[model samples]
Target: MIETTPGIIISFVLYLIFMLLIGWIFYRRTQNLSDYILGGRGLNTWVTSMSAQASDMSGWLLLGLPGYAYIAGLESIWIAVGLAVGTYFNWRFIAQRLRKYTQIAGNSLTLPDYFENRFRANSKILRIVSALFILIFFLIYTASGFVAGAKLFNTVFGLSYIGALSIGVLVIIAYTFLGGFMAVSWTDFFQGMLMFIAILVVPLIAIGTMGGIDSTAASINAKNSELLNALTQIDGTTISAISIISL
Candidate 1:
């Protein structure tokens, strides 16, 4: 959990306002189902890609990965490397092809609809099955996201867990219900920028606070020298090949 400050709180309040404002703006523009779902296929490449990659990751990248790194040292990089590779391949091949195909098939609004159309399935079985799987998986996934959000809010705002959770859920629900895909994409684009900046800048700030690279390394070395080694865990165990493969 992040420690809160006045600056952090102010920044977050502004961000929330911006997101809600975006939803309200888009809500007025949304007149038809297509506009609500796909933004009439009008999103530029930047918005699409930012939203795609940003939405791909959730609490795991921010919270879980950091925790893993603290526990496993540099061995946590296995997950990072895997995600980097997968994201590249996904961007290089999957995204564009999927977009074009979905448009050609039927301008499908959802994955299940796309699959049903792509396969030319006469029965609704394919769509139904896909929808069920998505529902089951997303129930778990969305719960995790909410949990992450709750923790983040509590950490940064010094709020009670239930209060934080309620605020987070209400903000998300308000925007999503009002503006749909346009709201989501635009907000995600800005949020993605913040995520990237945080990833790049936070460590540098930490290093500075610790006095420099040498001091930082000395601190880590004092605790556990194995943390400097990419293959070793903090507990002095060698990470297995299977562990690497699984990551």
Candidate 2:
């Protein structure tokens, strides 16, 4: 396949310009931390649901999920099932409660403030611990997203991996710092759609390219009988049974 280098570069520049435009719009509306962090906390259900789900899933839903399914066979479906179940529980139980609690806590604003007010006590330790947890987990989560972007850049454009990683981090931080929730939610809305299309399209293309499922299976088995069988070994131990356990 011939690489349309100029076309690719043009498309990338246009996409970046679109992102910057969105950030600029949000920045104009942003008057304080509230507008930046929570979009003034008046997000409607559709935006809230889409943004929350998009941010929560991040690159995992788009790249990792399909890759897992491809590598692990039908068993990987449990991961999707688990995510659906968790999402249902969150929407059904946690979402409303959190929304109410956040407001009732005198517009608590930050998470720690909400938590402290919920139990009606100024628990210094709990507040500190929660803040630390947020800092650590968010750092790791952001880092992971940067790593994914870097890998994509390396694979697509032949960029140095470290430079790609640094660029990824800077871009995310710039938009996020500039517009915060408005930037995140709006960007996620767009990114989530692209991700949905990508994950759906890639597997369909792969399947079509392989002729058909039955033929693909036959070809695989012909290459190696083991391809038709379950993976029996894991760290030199037989995987007798695998189950999902939630804590």
Candidate 3:
């Protein structure tokens, strides 16, 4: 947990203000259901890419990955490698085909709509089932983000858990209510950039603070020799190279 300082609090407040301002700015543009739902399907490649990445990752990139790496050391690299390969394949193969298919199939805007249209299903059951599943999963997904936000706030500001959670929820609801899709996309782009900067800067800072890579490596090896190796024994169990790759 980072120590709570005036500068950190000010900066966070300013960020929230900027996000709300963006919502206000985009609110006028969101005139109808389609615009609110899909940004009118008019996003450019960069916005689309960043927004997709941000939405997909949410707090996972900031919190979950770092936490996993801290605990698992080099073994965590396998998770990163797998994700990179999967993301590449998804972008290269699935994205274009999905976009084209969605456009051809009655201009479907939502996932449930797309599924129903794609199958040409006469029954409303498919849509209902899809919507129910989506609602359930999405609630779980959203709760994770809220929990991450609350923990972050509590750690940084020493706020009560409920207070932090309420703040997180309110801020999300406010911006989302003001401007639906566009606000979310634009904020996501900003957040993606912030995450990229943090990922790059934090490691460099940590390495420097620890007196460079050599010193850090020595400390890590002293603590747990296996942490220095991507595969093999960490404590007593030998993790095979094949198992590492499979991970």
Evaluated against the true structure, the overall lDDT of model 2 is 0.74
User: What lDDT score belongs to each candidate, Candidate 1 first?
Assistant: 0.88, 0.74, 0.88
What TM-score, to 2 decimals, does candidate 2 have?
0.86
lDDT of 3 by residue, 101-180 (tens): 98888888888998999999999999999999999999999999999989999999999999999998988889898999
Better of 1 and 2 by lDDT: 1
Compose the digit string of candidate 1's lDDT tens values, residues 40-100: 9899999998898777787777887888888777888889998989989988989889889
* Tens digit per residue, CA lDDT, model 2, 1-247: 2254988978876776777677878988999877887899877777777778778888767667667655655445556777889889989998788888898987777788887877777558767888899999998997777778888777777789998788777766777777788987887788777777877887778768999887778875666544345433222233344454230
Off by over 4 Å in 1: 1-8
Error of 2 at 241 (Å): 7.2
TM-score of every model versus the real structure: 0.93, 0.86, 0.94
lDDT of 3 at 120: 97
Model 2 misplacement above 4 A: 1-4, 220-242, 245-247
Q: If the candidates were sorted by their lDDT against the true structure, best first, what order would they fall in? A: 1, 3, 2
Q: Model 3 clash pairs?
A: none
